[model samples]
Target: MDKSDITLERLRSFVRVAERGSLSAVARELGVGQSTITRHLRELETALGVPLLNRTTRRVSMTDEGARYYANCLQILRLVEQAGDEARATRGAPAGTIRISCTAAIGVLHVTRLIFAFQDRHPDIGIDLSLTDERVDLVREGVDVALRLGPLTDSSMKLRNLGHSRRLLVAAPDYLAAHGRPAAPQDLSGHEGIRMTNVAGSDTLVLQGPDGARHTVPFGGRFRVDHGLAAREALAAGRGIGSAHRWLVDDLLSAGRLEVILPDYVPLSVPLNMLIVPQRTGIARVRLLVDFLAERIRAIPGIEQTR
Candidate 1:
């Protein structure tokens, strides 16, 4: 028989005999009889074309050839162990491509940065991101992970709380200085406002004032956009006083390009969540990406910290 036909059982028996130096001792450890151990060793020796052991009635030892063969077997066994470890490591690590979807505004403001950080840590992992304002079916679209804002409607998908973002009424410093800032929620009626439409085509703004009273402001603008990013760009260009997630305009606010119109009347913080299909929960790549994004989103400036 060729070397490929040699059985691991025979190699194990030879190693046991070489280590114990006695057929009876090796057989005892292997849970086999002494004759059985001798037969296995003979089979291995026959396959290798080399006598592997020096056998005697009083004692057993390795011949010169047997010593060399045992040395080779030891090296092979060590290599086998190393190969098994590498396989296990690949299975546990995040190494596959993950599909993700998010709104254009959030994607540009937050998700894009997190994706870059995740890629830096796991270079082997590929990320496919689809940015749109439309509500996408996670399973139908074949998305592995999704970043969603506000309340979620689909109960079938698994949701993990990432953090929360406050909707702030903001305007360009020039616009606010020219038209003057609204002193109260009711004052927005006389001021020019910008509105964003969701998939449902309805728009509503809710705010919580310093007096601990919740105010729902209902208004329509001369200009309406379907995406937050477009609405933010319009607001930055001095279109009108627009409301957007605080996280999205953090840089603009910090640089004095945009100013919070109503500081005392801040809107309610909307929960931001990471949604994943239930079937993908156990997948190593999906789980790793979800966890990494959750931690990073929570650290974003102006967003509520998650516990």
Candidate 2:
């Protein structure tokens, strides 16, 4: 026989029936209707041009040819199951290079550490990180995932919202000593403020009090930077007070290198995002990296929630 018409489903049904020696039992075990099993067996026998089972009123038994065919069916089914398992194992284990693009300062301050942690869990996965102030064309740049920390516009790319981190107005101890720390959100307008020219709404700073009260203050200074790393360096040098995310200044705050502006008021919360191509979201490696990132990044000390 050419065997072209014999389907894998038919083979599995025939094998189960032969092994169990009862069509009804095979149907119950497989959770399929008895008619389905019977059809599969009938089609399989028709394709082979021979009766594979000898049926009586009480019991069913395999003929000589049927016995030989059962042996072949078991071998084929085992091979097929092995193939499926191998495919699943490969998908389950992420092992490939991922190209990532992100803002320079946060990438250095927080994202890099997270990447190291992810690599520790998945030793087979490799990451290429590109830190820049300019927006990257993920398609042309071949970036698998891009971590963005500011406002988002309409895009065809898929975005996973990790969480929102509040911005804290911070300045070096030296700068605070020189300028005198702002006691309230409105007081920030009087002091020299480090402004981020690259982000929208940079000129106006919004601060939220512990009581859920909110207010806006105009922020400007002699120092204007488009990049956060540059601004961080300037801030570290005691240039001017600037609002930064918790992740960016966690170490500095812990080490007493920098101090918060209005302890009672917090700056606007910025959403952390991971952008991926719409079509590539289902890829095993990409999906694994995103899931791992979401889990670890949300666990960072000051993150609010993964919305």
What C-alpha lDDT values do all the predictions have? 0.78, 0.80
Report clashes for each candidate as comma-separated counts. 0, 0
**Model 1: residue 287 alpha-carbon error in angstroms:** 1.3
Tell me each candidate's RMSD, in Å, in order: 19.8, 17.8
Q: Identify the candidate with maximal lDDT.
A: 2
Residue 162 lDDT, candidate 1, scale 0-100 = 74
lDDT of 2 by residue, 1-307 (tens): 6577699988978876776678887788678999999999888888899999987767678999999998787677656654554576666665667888987887887789989988988887789899986776675455678888776783878988888877788899998888787887778788888888888888888888789988988987898888787877788889989988777778788989988877888887888788986545655667777888888887675677854
How many Å off is the CA of 216 in candidate 1?
2.7
Prediction 2 global C-alpha lDDT: 0.80
TM-score of each: 0.68, 0.66
